[model samples]
Target: MIKVEQLSFSFPQKELYTNISFTLEEGQHCAFIGTSGSGKSTLIDILMDPDRYLFDGRLEMEPGCSIGYVSQFAQPDTSADTTVFEYIGASFIKLQNEIESICSEMETSSDIEPLLDKYQLALDAFDAMGGNDFESNIHKQLNLANLMKRRDLKVSDLSGGEFKLVQVMKEMLNRPDLMIMDEPDVFLDFDNLNALKQLINSHKGILLVVTHNRYLLNHCFNKIIHLENMEIQEYDGRYIEYNFSLLQTKIELQELTLAEKEEIERNENIIDNLRAIATYNSEASRGRALKARVKFQERLEARRIKAPFVDIKQPEIHFGIDHDVQDLTVLKVDQYRAAYDELLLDKVSFEMKSTDKVALIGPNGTGKTTLLRDIANNHPDSITLHADAKVAYLSQLQGEVLKDSNTLLEEFIDAGMSTYDEIRAHLAGYGFEREILNQRIESLSGGEKNLLQLAKVAVSNADLLLLDEPTSHLDTYTQIALDQAIQDYKGAILMISHDFYSVVNGMDYVLIIDDKTVRRMTIKKFKKMIYARHFDKDYLELEQQKKALETKIELALKATDFELAQSLMDELEALIKLL
Candidate 1:
């Protein structure tokens, strides 16, 4: 078990968590969530190396507790030629290498006794670590993750998502007591995402995962640790349950607060009348009543409800266009072909309407990002655009759009904003504080950088937006905001995304990259394809029903039907458990 008490931390420029406390019991799988740049990853760093930080806290962990960490930005060395099987069995291989080295040394030198002892020790340790069955174990893990076919592939040859899964597999093979994965679900496709879910659910050790993947949050974790507004709210239940309870509490509190405000308004009106009458008639009783009412109003104001955690702040992301495209086809690609080390795209063709919201989806490493980038650049040989169309691109790699060394203020100014105050005011809407304006872009979190990218995209006033994995690093609320923005956008959008819900709910249809060609699929077919691949129809239908019930329950709570709301909530809970 791990326990923290009254933990408070701050940087020179910003305060993070304060007086926050939570405990991670032996078997809890906790999902850590918060706004972008709210220090979720920083908290994990502190946990991994408590002595590196100076903060007010009491953090206690069980003695001899082992930890395995999968960092968000960790990548396999491209220069290394290790295969997946060899990489996962590295420990066994290391022991084997040491034993072989000792035997070779004994043959060459007069250190036979010492070498034999070392070899025996190495053999014992290897056997104890199950190294004798290392190959079989590695193969079993590969099969479980459905990567047996790729077991012999070089780790560096894998896509980012595949490499991330390989990293998870490598860490899990170590069998640590606790595992902490930061944003492990970021670039994963549907099938790999399900594989991650299975890994998380099947792990016997503790897990503290930092992620905003709704699918994983719903399916993997039993606990939630939300860091928002410099406070921590830990829930000892599934994310859906915590979310439902939180929404219910927020609704009830908001209603009560609204009623209180109304009452206070009435009292203020009465107080003003009493004061007016007292001033005109000079009556002592009227003066006393006015004073009494004033005091009552103060008391009421003092008792106003403040639900900081529930009233979470969401970035205001809006994608706008200055004008509509005159032509029906905003973008067109015909017989487009591209290659990198190997053929990625071939004879791919697609066109986007002026108002089309299309998802460009395929498995990882299928040239989705490549295709989007090429279109955004308008490759002269293969792509064409409407005469009136202005394009804005948001790259999955933030660095493609944002300069790392530039400060936020400078970045926005360079993006065409004129003045500091104007830039500050614009960024404020995206939840960036004024103080962070001078912070370098590289210092920002992945979410913050993406938010900055979105903020930049919002001002481009382009009729065509090429968004590659726009929702990957964003928080759930910002993802929702983006979905709404996409829905409401008057411009054309060809979004490359792996987020299932975002694609299904936000896009009109999908342009799938299959067999080196682009094929248009209706939203219905897209959903069916996804459901067939990653989920069952029953589970999908149940999830849809669950969402409807949640909406109804919220409405019942708002209508002040306590009994009905309770019944609906109970039903929702049962449904959530089933899910």
Candidate 2:
């Protein structure tokens, strides 16, 4: 349906892509992935409206094909009073109305030929869109998303995450030739994420999705378009299989590179010795041997492996604590009550001791953000902070903690702890370039802003950290880095997250907001809860075995023993069947 060949694009400050090429065929679900600030979203913009930008490329879409788009920050129009069902069926309704109007005009018009032609066009469009069963299709999508009860709800009344799902259903039901969704999984809860997976899997048309959610990456896409090192690579296979292929190739190339390095070093030593002997003996043969060794060394250096795919640079993220809180209780909340349009949280209580790591989790719009804010603000009646505790917060709404008008440099300098040069160096570690130091915070991608927030939190030296959905916009590599940072952090942390891997792996326990109150659940129970809801009954056990077998396979591959590797792969295949 769509093809891009040798596409190259750049901005004044940075060159994003150089000769990137890919294709989207019917029934292929493509996952567009890249590191934060790698211009995946920008590429989507180019695809959606090629005329808006001047670039070098051949971008072609078959004639008469239609495109559907969902932006990264799509929100329902609050001023509109459209119901969810009406919104989803808007396209079908419009065509139906046009056909009816044309028929009415035919009843009295003198130019009957044009009216008949218009009627035929409208009918064709409606039939192509499945208008005969549009309502049933809408209900089916809503039911699959578990939003049937909210079909009559105003689009303006839905939560942000719910509205995102509604947007997906609206676009999918329209049955456009190609659908492009940019980070549509952001801010969605566990159930919604699963629902999104189903929607992507069931989509029949061509799909190009920009996402970083591991679950979706594993389950949704059949093709991978990876943007890295100012280039693009396409893999016509599952992401898991593509990833394994990359790993295997990287391992082999690394071994070859290591051998080349040893040869170069040995040649260098021999060359030095030969030159020294030639200088002493004035021998022509010695000089010629030295020249030969030099050439060999140069050749080895030229052919050395540069594995961009495997050697992708990851942001260095470390949450450092200068000192530990001596207080037994770092924070405590009792009888906490908060409300917006209605009472969302009532009599909610929770506490965290020093060095404790806990996750605050609940459904979307369940006052998780409100409770985190109250704790950060130190509400006198219900929330308490120890006298010895110094707290730092990373808000889900990046704008709340950062000024849109300020430049990246100015924002960091406002902290009064680092000089201009020092701040620039620190931001570099978090993957910000010096050229964009004066760039406004508002211009950054969502992942970049979240990364900046993480950089700030890293330097706070606070003994208590409050993080809300820290992994929402981060790329997978950065997310894994954050998981490690959270695991290694010495301070007490109360984080609000819907990412199941982060919760089950990094957190000590979970503080679940249930029935407008707070309760604690062990990590084991939390794992069980997720496995039961999202996987087969035996999936958890089989997944564990698979991971172990994968580790053994990696070890065998590292030893360059294909026999052992194949044996482990067989075991893994059997375990995967159970999963």
**Model 2 ranges off by over 4 Å:** 107-113, 281-289, 325-327, 378-380, 538-579
Each model's TM-score?
A: 0.90, 0.92
Q: Give the candidate number with the greatest TM-score.
A: 2
The digit string of per-residue lDDT tens for model 1 on 1-579 reads 888899999999899989999988888999999999889988899899999999898999888778999988888899999998888888889889998888888889875887788889999988877778778867777787888899989999988878888889888877778899999998888788888887888787889999999889888889999988888888999888888888778767877887898999999899878877876788787878888889999999999998877787777888887664454988889899889899999998878888888988888998888888887774757899888788899998888999999999999889899999899889999988777888999999999999899999999999989998899889988987887788788888888888887887788999887798888899888888777777755676687688678668768866877678778877887887777
- Tell me which residue pairs clash in candidate 2: none
Per-model RMSD to reference: 3.2, 2.9
> Residue 548 of model 2: what lDDT?
66
- Cα deviation at 86, candidate 1, in Å, is 1.4
| Global lDDT of model 1 | 0.86
* Steric clash count of candidate 2: 0
Candidate 2: tens digits of C-alpha lDDT, residues 410-431: 9988866568889888888888
In candidate 1, stretches whose alpha carbon ends up further than 4 angstroms from where it belongs are 100-124, 127-133, 262-300, 324-327, 419-421, 541-578
